[model samples]
Target: MNSKIPKSIDEYIKNFPNEVQQILQTIRSTIQKEVPEATETISYAMPTFVLNGTLVHFAAYAKHIGFYALPSGNIAFQKEISKYKFGKGSIQFPLNEPIPYGLIKKIVKFRVNENLEKTKKRIQKKKSKPNHE
Candidate 1:
């Protein structure tokens, strides 16, 4: 495994195999296009995109590439992702299968909206809190 944490999504994609690298690159580009404000980094040993918090993460596995949108994402995509193997925040795309780039983009956009809502709520909560100091 590469010990270096990539500064950009392109460098992160270069760390993977040729084919998987291509898929990762496409996913990264789509996310960037959708969420221009998001910052890229390697978190939890996977390539993560963050806005107010983690928006999504993607990593290469032996037989599949995993995309993690966290908590509610799995539930939101459950019906569309039912055919594929997935966990709470992850969906595995088999190495031999075609990557659902559109779906990934849609998920990224949804995450962006989710993060914005969270940030708004957090700010509102902070404003409503009493300062006792």
Candidate 2:
């Protein structure tokens, strides 16, 4: 795990190899463009976007890039993303393939909405609970 936290996502991307840096920059920009309010941070040694809550996390790997939208993100994109390789909460995009920027944007947007909905539901649940004396 990288012990240092990047000042900004741009700084984080700059630290990677030129090729990986380009892809990472694209991913970072896409997330920022879609979720303007998202805060960039280093979490789990990877770059993470925190919106209404923790929205998504991405990392540069040896042969591919890993995008993680935890909880149920993989399940949501399973069918649509079957062509690409993936894991529990991650989807891997090989360096050779044209990076799927559009799909990545869509996934980030989906995660933002998902987190917002979860927050709303949690608030509603709290409101419905009777206060104990």
Candidate 3:
């Protein structure tokens, strides 16, 4: 939440308090554990994981942590996430509440699969297209 754009996830996490730092790292690890091949970066000033496209993005806010797994991810898990505060592509997990690591893992896995499927379709589309060259 500083003016400086964190070059890496580590830098972004360090800007938070110890408790928030712990939560952020746990979320990062949960995503990585689910998809070992996912790449990490700082996107939109938050810690982001990318596979075929962005897997997920998370950031610590004053009273809550914002978890973004894109619109598809949120929509797919609508029932499970309904209890929490959510948006088109984002979920706000309050700091006072227990962070649902299990739910986070599920969401990450879903996004990983979704992203991979998109990549597959893109490849198939290219294969079906007539060569112009």
Candidate 4:
């Protein structure tokens, strides 16, 4: 990993080798395909997509690609993610093995819907609130 933090997703991907760059690009495009409206930026030194909130994040590591789809997203696809190395909210797709782009797409789509629903609920709550003034 580079010492200076990346300012953008393209800069972050350029920091890696050709093989890793391709993998990162595919993952980025997969997330984009799932949530084309999501904005891309660098968050926590990784590539992150933000809509109403963060839709998903991914970074290339020495041995694996670290993916953060939020805890709920991981819980939602426990069976599929169980095959990878995972923690509370993050999953690692090993560089050696074939990356599951399809699963990544699904998880991203789930996260997009989750965030959108939460945003909608928050708006509804605000609209229903009684004005104090």
- Model 3 TM-score on a 0 to 1 scale: 0.96
- Using alpha carbons, what is the TM-score of model 2? 0.89
TM-score of each: 0.89, 0.89, 0.96, 0.97
Query: Relative to the true structure, how large is the alpha-carbon lDDT of every model?
Result: 0.86, 0.85, 0.93, 0.92
Error of 2 at 82 (Å): 0.6
Give the local distance difference test score of model 3. 0.93
Candidate 2 clashes between residue pairs 3 or more apart in a chain or in different chains: none
Per-residue accuracy of model 2 over 1-133 as CA lDDT, tens digit each: 2548776666678777898998998899899999989899988777899977899999887788888888478788788678888878888888888888888888888898899999999999999999998
Worst 10 residues of 1 by lDDT: 1-10
Full candidate order by lDDT, most accurate first: 3, 4, 1, 2
Taking the tens digit of each residue's C-alpha lDDT, what string does model 3 give over 25-73? 9998898899999899999988999999899999999999999989998
> For residues 1-133, could you state the per-residue lDDT of candidate 4 as single tens digits?
7799999999999999999999999999888887888899999888999999988889898999999988999999999999898998999999999999999988988988899899999999999999999
Candidate with the greatest TM-score versus the true structure: 4
Candidate 1 residue lDDT tens string, 90-114: 9998989989888898888888888
The backbone clash count of each candidate, in order, is 0, 0, 0, 0
